[model samples]
Target: MSDSIDSPIIIDLPYEEGGKKYDEDIFARALQTETHQKTGQVESSNVTEYHLRILLHYPAVYVIHAEESHSQRSEPEYCVYVGETNDISQRTYEHLYNDPQNRDDWRLFNNHGNMSQYVITHPYFNKSLTLDIENQLMLYMSSVDHVSLPVNKRVNPQRDYYTHDRFKRIFSDIWLDLHRKNPSLFPAEGIILDSALFKASPFHKLSDEQLEAENIILSEIFAALHLESPDQIATDKTNPADSHLILVQGAAGTGKTVLLSHLFYRLLTQTLPEEDAPLIHSPASAWKSDDKHQDGDHASQRNLIPKEDISAYILVNHDEQIHVYNQIATKLGLQNRSGTVVLKPTEFLNRHSRKNDRHRALLNEPIDKADVLLVDEAHLLLTQGNRAYSGKSQLFDLLNRAKVVVAVFDPNQILQSSQRLSPKIQKLLSPADDSAANPSNNGNDDEPSRIQLDDYNNAKPLTVDVSHIRLQQQFRIDASPEVIAWLDAFTDEGIIGELPADCHEHAWHADDSVDTRSKPYDIRVFDSPVDLFDAIKKKAEIKADGCDGKGLSRLLATYDWEYTSKHKNANDPSGHWNVELHQDGTGTWRMGLGGGDGTDNTSHDRCFCQPWNYQLTDPHSHRKGLNKDQAWAEKPYTINEVGSTYTIQGFDLNYAGVIIGPSVQYQDGKVMFHPENSKNKNATNSRKDLGDFAEENLKDELNVLLKRGVHGLYLFAVNPQLQQRLMDVYEASKND
Candidate 1:
């Protein structure tokens, strides 16, 4: 409680070689006062006294950073460590001298020869607030393009505290002030907030459900990995095929990916006491946690004697999503002397399994097993043989190469025949049977149930264990329960019921809300594709006031148009495949190719037309835009192109203009889905094993397309009946 609260303080100090011993000089300067006192008299004022006491006793957060990439021909990569402590001098001393002896990150910061640290403080600093601040710093640094590695790995997001309401403004203020000091190190806050990596960062504040799921995952991992000490157990001799699976079930935008990312970071932060190697058995004598290594204590000194590094891998199937994961893994230093840590399932399988397994597993040689494998978008994992993979099941193949496999599965997101979950597997994943034979899977995720698999080669009786945890909240849509329910009904069950009264209400901007400045979540239906795209661009334009604009809007559609990958269309010589709609409200369905110049007849006004994904020339061909690695949707020029489930599946947009193609239509009393209308073979094709899944596949594609918008979803249906129905619903809701 100073007389007036001042802004956060930021000062960068050099860690010089052969300099004076470290001291608390930053706070010492803050404590300096121009008090005119007699030689023996001591000054006393409540304001000064209060400031002095808090400065001496209160908590503060700090960041230490040094260049990691030292190549003369390349750019500098800063390795950053974020932390909070009550005693700055003691903590810095511990990190500088003692911590370097244990952790490699600390050693680099200590011996890099050129190092600088930023010590931050504020009048409102407390244990909780400082810890949250430190976590937020980690979240941002993990996504910053220039920061190559994050030294801090622990998750310390706190619940509501005394000053919880001020956290966002305070953190942004601190970051902005710091940005003024160093632009490269601390870029614009808005730019960072708009990144995919930032949205999926591990340091974010988890919902109660996410936090609960994280705790459950961690406990399961500990229980599985802590079965015995490293030396006592025969891990090398044990079979890797007996690995367990933790299946997290949730629909799209339900925060499944965030929970998975948190688990991935947390699992890597753990350590098993393995002088020889890691073990799955519990031995109390040697087991210890390396979670708090950033607490500035050498492992040995603090009895955290972890000799073996925990083997962990995070895999994904989607290209865009895997890109995001690899960036995060690289920035968090989530790797070792071995190759990459984040990889595709095929890469993981190919690397760990014997090459003969594409034909057969190498005889006698053991599988190169990892301690844990975390799979995101597991629904996309192929179940049958393909060109790159010859396995029976990717999930089973993953289990064969690791001690544990944790998968995030959403049966609804399965968009291909190859990835289709068979009836048997679906039954195993989300058990609908509550019989005595499968009582454990009675809709309870507290304990995992067992799944029997016909052994890899039918050589032995092998069964894999499976667990199911459900996440029900929709995190992507910034709307109320009624709004979300309407979306779910419209997409999931295909029931175009009356829109909710508050379907357009902004949940964050209610009269009784904390942040009432955000714009409402827009839900509209447009008659013209041109109008829909125009509205999306209108929303995409940067707003002057509080619309929470990230300046990204995209036009998406159902898989109805023919789009060949990388093939230049001969009809339209622009070298781009276009999704065309003529001025008469007719689309590719009527014209027999959306882009045939509308040559059939009538006037070709080109009402609405845009290139499909990967067809546009490089918008950042001159140089890397923003000097950072970006996903397909993050690029500035992608706005001109239409995205599909492949490029934009695991991303978010400010607003989405989705054109419901001929695949989805409405009739007298119900909605109809036409599989034959869609050109996406992945959705419309049939499998030799599982006959016809076209209906569900197309539905899932529409589901993903409609849910991409965070603040809004505008629609234009190619089918007239569907279009009229949607418009009628909008008009009815408006007049009411």
Candidate 2:
């Protein structure tokens, strides 16, 4: 067991007294005498003033010293003072009885009674000295009380009256005894005795077990501490001579959020010179106090600005993820009174609004007035263009003001239609700009220049780059390793070694009905827009009976299937598929509707009309509108009929039935999935080629969709050729 101090212990003493002079020799001899009485030591002459004070203040020790000194008038004065006391009253009584003899020796005394009075006055001349001595005495008495046992046990006391050496011994004993009684109570095993005892003890160093535990904790702290801002990183890397930018890529479940939070903590806690400290605005600064000025005016007054600035560990994401990040920040104790801000696309537009002159005015102000910027999901950034001015995205504008910028993005998940890096951002991340020299430019001035903007105009700034570290090892899947492996082998086909055998054996299983020709693992696809409507209605009915436990009529049908189908089909086929599939996959389908004409239009024209009826046309307006009447002339569409791709991306059913509508695939080879036909014709082609890209793209999407089940896949093809191609791919990949 090693001896180290386990917990903090404080000792307070009275202030020191001055004025009286003493003979060093006599003081030394008196200390030796006290030491001999307490610890049988003859080496008291070697003791320091500090040790002498401790001995004198010890509860059971005392020191008496006599001294003589010349006054300013050249008169010799003699004085004597007692430096310790066991009983105050008894000591004073003794001093009174001996005062007469001491006074008779003084020539200044007029008479014996006067001499005694003068002698006593010499000792108590300074009331401050007396107070100090009293305070010291009280301090030692308190120490005795602290370590003392109960009053009843004082008589049979565990130890004798306190001595300097005895106090040291007992303190060590008590600390060790506590450890022996409850070892686990200490943070680490073993105990740290008092410093004095630690020096004396042979076992003062850490044990092997203790050292190992200390190393573990130290490692965790070090890892947590290394996270810093780009500026700080630059300073650390000794690269302050050049400006640089860094990008961090990480996937979900990685410690990106935790790392960012740690960085913020470090930035806030960093010690900066008084003048150089970063100016930060706190939530309190934005709030007004109720207190009025002395003039009794009604004007609002700002609260006192705290000397310490309150900064945040901000987590930036789309509006949908804001609630989740806010909850995480709150859990980590980083949330402040100002609350979290979710920077939506519209908010960005509002900040740089063309129509709002006031907003434009605000944009012209100095940018450094804000704190550092941290962007998560950086890949979602997009550029803007207008007839008046070529514009950069809101994210680029924010980067100009921040001294340190930290961004996290996964290149694989860039979902925006225009998913190309802006020139400024590209320069920041990868400085070598080769786009200008490309032969395809043909000296055309109409083409946008790919020049990097020197936005900050700073002499030098720091940049730090970090790669994504795997955190998948920590996720424990509660399924058979074999089953999980089989699913991963198919869905993540090219990405090998992802699923272990343990994951596949415990996976859940489900089978499909043979009549539907749908394998248990196959995703159910609707035959046509009308068939999709019917299938959804049937599912809703089943859900109402089995899960919702309510009559089908009770469930509200917010959107008319026919109207939604027509409106969705109105878009270019690729755009339509992208909106439906991505929205449904990411569980953000609601955002797609919340943003556009989906919210506007007359009551009848709105896709989601009121009431629970899923009919394609209003019964009351059956004969009112000619076009609407013709559309719904055949039969009423019910909730059981309509389905959207968004509702079933990651899900799998026992049987899958797909309907390839003519809008997507035509016999004349007018394929909507062709890369050349896409909105951005020049975009890089994925594994799927031009003409049949839609069907091929659906292969992977459907793979992700179907493998969610345990047994098999059931796929239906409305277009025989497209269906045959999909089946061929699936069958070929199965053996591989």
Candidate 3:
């Protein structure tokens, strides 16, 4: 079955020189009565209701043609305005003769010009259903061969679809009827499929699995909206919201961000029927003074509350992630809408926080103001209150405000202890009945300590269900199944010392020769950290120069070295010294730290310093052979080593050179972490407290750093013993 239906009516528009022309008058009750009302007679309240019923008798679409008053005027063009209105008589009246100061100012209506309109109605017509059909017609007209497209500024609808498929089919039939009347004004069915509006749609080109996921999610949203009533106002004193909590779990690169971006895009474009328009325009009392509808309008008064088209907001913790989402919204033309917003979780809370005294007066909104909240990287949500976040918990705050909350979850992605959720949310995110508590096949030999969500206050009520959906397919990297299994096990399971014989046979064998040219992904181990660094630099340079059709090759390491930037004069920005790298020379080549402001007789070579990834693009480049002036602006990968998850987290790269610093070493045939050598404060959390949160956090950090590479991963161990142990483990797995 085709998705779009062709218009049945064919017409050679006036401009079609020799072509046959079909003419049909699409008269509606509203436009028919407009002539009688032009005498400037005031309508009684009862009579107004009669006209309102006639205009809104059925869900219908109306097209207003702006025609020239003079017959000798240049040949008329189909520069029409397409819209959907339940109360067409009232809506068109306002368009034609409403207050000249604030109403629509179509020049054709301003002059003594004649106007005509076409109406398409259906038996199953409702405001939302007609709006959906109206938008489709607009898209179709814009893509066809016309002298001028409809005067619609944005033809893309703000929604993916209406609530039900039955209504959708009815809308399709309405399109067919319109097309039959004026086939020349519409594109063929195939043209509709390839239309620019369709191409730019967020739901475009989705895989079957992704489409299914979208359908399930949309169905849930539809169900939730159906349960909402017109009388329940979010501005009311009593809270009537029945919010649902949905949990979707996926590891890095599982396309969570993409899905959320599209969801927000479709939501922003959703058109509200006339009755629901006031929901977004301030509180109901505030709209009573609206200049355009100040005449005790019955149609406007009835729409003070919305039944659907509720507002949605997206909250993300990471600046990098939020920036990506903002760019996606802008691409879909959804950034300017007031109903949707993409902001940091902290910023969102601060904006809504009663603490902001200035905004509190007018915006003292109920907790349930937001209808839908989409949280990306929800594992990063904070649990405890701090100076930055005054709220008890972000998860709890979001659930309090939204009727439907969908969050992407990954327990492994939790970076710190402070970024935890409440006990109720944790229980909701726990593995379900069919889920495995642990899997030996993927890698972890032992389970980490279970996260403690029960430590939260028990007084808060928990009313929402924690439905779970897990995405298992990995999309970031292309590698053999054995390699994938091996990498996961190696990262999660403590695989530093001699591996068990059974583990070796399961993942490796001597016959597994690496064929880089034919392999989907490549992995290699280097004896020297410098050699690995050089390979990564070469790949980065080649990719940057477009010699290899790729980019994002980088060098990453454990946070073992201290990063310092000292300036000679506090006031002089140019007096800043190069970023310095230090610690036993175990990591990589670096400028000796003895130089002071270029006065000391010490070698002032290059050193590593963490660059601000979020604030600046191409920050203090690492390219080599730069003159003193050019050195500071080189490519980031040109630098020898990049450390810390702050720079690489939530990012992807083609290849990564990983340096296992001195912090990780083989002692007594077991891998040991010396917390004293680490520079990261977060990493040192394991020092005084061993076999606890800090230790697991360090492990998770290392796993994340190594997995940053998408196409290839190369390892170089700074500690000779650890390096030798790794080689031994790989060698033992070579049983053919």
Query: Which candidate number has the best lDDT?
Result: 1
* Clashes found in each candidate (C-alpha, N, C closer than 3 A): 6, 36, 12
Instruction: Predict model 3's lDDT versus the native.
Output: 0.50
Give candidate 2's TM-score. Answer: 0.33
**Tens digits of per-residue lDDT for model 2, 513-601:** 11212112222332222333344344334321110021121111111122333244454332232211112222221212232423432
Regions of candidate 2 where Cα sits further than 4 Å from its true position: 1-310, 313-340, 345-358, 361-374, 384-395, 403-406, 422-503, 507-672, 675-720, 727-736
lDDT of 3 by residue, 1-736 (tens): 0111111111111211122221222222232343234435444546444334433465557765544332433344355566666654455555554434454434433442444566555444555555556666654444332323313333223333443344434544555555555554443454443222322234433434343454445445544454455644644564433466666666666656556655564455533224333332211221221223422221234433232356778887865555545534543335553224777776665565454454431122333357778898887787765567655567766765667788877777766656744455565557544253222122111221222222223324435544445566665555555666666765666555333322122221121222113234656677555467677877666432111134557777776655443324242254432223432334433232433434332323333333322223344344332212111112342354464576566556667778777766677866667666666665454322122365555666677777767678878666777777776765675542
For every model shown, what is its TM-score relative to the native structure?
0.85, 0.33, 0.55
Alpha-carbon lDDT of model 1: 0.70
Q: Looking at model 2, report the run of 10 residues with the lowest lDDT sum.
A: 148-157
Q: Which stretches of candidate 3 lie over 4 Å from their true place?
A: 1-204, 230-242, 270-308, 337-340, 356-368, 421-425, 434-460, 496-518, 544-548, 563-643, 666-674, 683-692, 727-736
Candidate 1 lDDT tens digits, 149-170: 5466566677878876666656
